[model samples]
Target: MKEGWTWRLPCALASALLLAACSGGGARDNPDDSVLHQDIASGRAGAEVTFDGTLRADPQPVGTHEHLTVTTPAGDVLEVDHNTSLAPWVPAHAGDHVIVHGELYIDPGPRAGVHCTHAHTSSGCPRPGWVELGGNYYE
Candidate 1:
């Protein structure tokens, strides 16, 4: 019985290590915004994306979310829906450059945008999201 327990101990440790690695944390090493651009072009939604854009307008209150319209350097306009309930409002204005990380959601007209931009505390948000403006990070 002692010998069997010893053998199983190593297996248990190995399984825990693998599980820790698979559990998501931090952002991927996407150096450029090309992947995000591709996601937009392909009309893919529900993907975690990060990119920089120029604020096209001031943030507006839409329910619990602070809505922002930003234009990517590549000429694509993206809506950034930061959940004010989960995070603080970004003190940004039109023409301010900003960095955004969130889950993408595509829809017709002005409904398409990114959401879930907040800190992740559980499985509901697989990847943590945040907004960076004027050197301040909001999660």
Candidate 2:
């Protein structure tokens, strides 16, 4: 009985360790981890550029504020906020590919986008400073 218990203890511990490693140890619990808050804190607002990266969406707060953290290809992070219609793309899951086009707002807060919207569409969303998207068609 003693020998069996001793072997089982180590096996149980080893199984627990393997499970923790495979589970990612709750790393995805905090969705804001991908957003580079340090850069926004250092006064790098109003700097607009095309950023492409994996999309991580926070599940909390429902759809009023669609929070998306983009991990840029160059390793920089940017958070995109869509205050408009959040029904289309809220509660996004991690690992979703996303591309954002908007100016960085500096005043009244950290570097973040205001009035930003998603660029995902069957026909492709419109680029900034060119045309507005999702409206009555005019030719």
Q: TM-scores across all candidates?
A: 0.73, 0.41
Please write out the lDDT profile of model 1 over residues 99-120, one tens digit for every residue. 8888888897634588878885
Residue 122 Cα positional deviation in candidate 2, in Å, after optimal superposition: 25
User: Looking at candidate 1, what is the lDDT of residue 89?
Assistant: 92
TM-score of 2: 0.41
Which is the leading candidate under TM-score?
1
Candidate with best lDDT: 1
How many angstroms is residue 118 displaced in model 2 relative to the true structure, after the best TM-score fit? 6.5
Per-candidate count of clashing residue pairs (backbone under 3 Å)? 0, 0
TM-score quality measure for candidate 1 = 0.73
Candidate 2, pairs of clashing residues: none
The global C-alpha lDDT for each of the candidates, from Candidate 1 onward, is 0.81, 0.47
